[model samples]
Target: MAFNTCVSVIRSASHKAQMIHNQDVQAVSTDVINADELWSFVKKSKSTVNRKS
Candidate 1:
């Protein structure tokens, strides 16, 4: 059915993505990196601030 085809496509894409991330990316060394900046960049946003008092 159409649903099964869609599921198969999604799974395939996910598998490919995982392979690339795991294999294509290399480990970094001999360089300085700021943890806070890396976390913020990966998260794609600044820390949340509560509005309620």
Candidate 2:
């Protein structure tokens, strides 16, 4: 029972992370006009991203 519970929790967390990632992809695609725009956005924001946080 303990193993099953751990598996269930892990699956749930994975699904949630996937959903958030999909949302981020959709948001970026909609906001970005083209490849250049996306690249520029990332380049400009690269310094602001927290690596381990």
Candidate 3:
């Protein structure tokens, strides 16, 4: 009765928390990849400029 209701509520909250955590992890990974790509592009352009000069 009341106990089962409490258990269900707790399970629901836990599931929501897990979902939010997964989303955060995904966002961080995407940011890291973007940063790496930007860094590589900057390096390449710098090298090309140096070669021309």
Candidate 4:
């Protein structure tokens, strides 16, 4: 039961990461057509990388 719980936890975390990655990609696409949105994404991406580091 504990092992199953761990596996589920990992899967949930992975799913969340994937969702965030997808949103980022979408934001990039949106940015291409919109300069304002692009700047917003750039700022957010820099913050995310900083937080990770």
What C-alpha lDDT values do all the predictions have?
0.74, 0.83, 0.89, 0.90
Query: Candidate 4: TM-score?
Result: 0.47
Greater TM-score among 1 and 3 belongs to 3
For residue 2, what is the lDDT in candidate 4? 100
lDDT of candidate 2 over 1-53, digit per residue (tens): 69999999999999999999998877763543558988888976885675534
TM-score between candidate 3 and the true structure = 0.48
Model 2 compared with the native: what TM-score? 0.49
Could you give candidate 3's per-residue lDDT for residues 1-53 as a string of tens digits? Answer: 69999999999999999999999987763433447888999999999999999
Worst 10 residues of 3 by lDDT: 26-35
**Regions of model 3 farther than 4 Å from truth:** 29-53
Q: Tell me the tens digit of each residue's lDDT in model 4 across 1-53.
A: 69999999999999999999998887664434648988999999999999999
Mark the regions of model 4 whose C-alpha exceeds 4 Å error after superposition. Answer: 29-53
* Each candidate's clash count: 0, 0, 0, 0
By lDDT: ranked, best first: 4, 3, 2, 1
Best by lDDT, which number? 4
- Return the TM-score for each candidate structure: 0.46, 0.49, 0.48, 0.47
Once fitted onto the true fold, the runs of candidate 1 whose alpha carbons sit more than 4 angstroms away are: 30-53
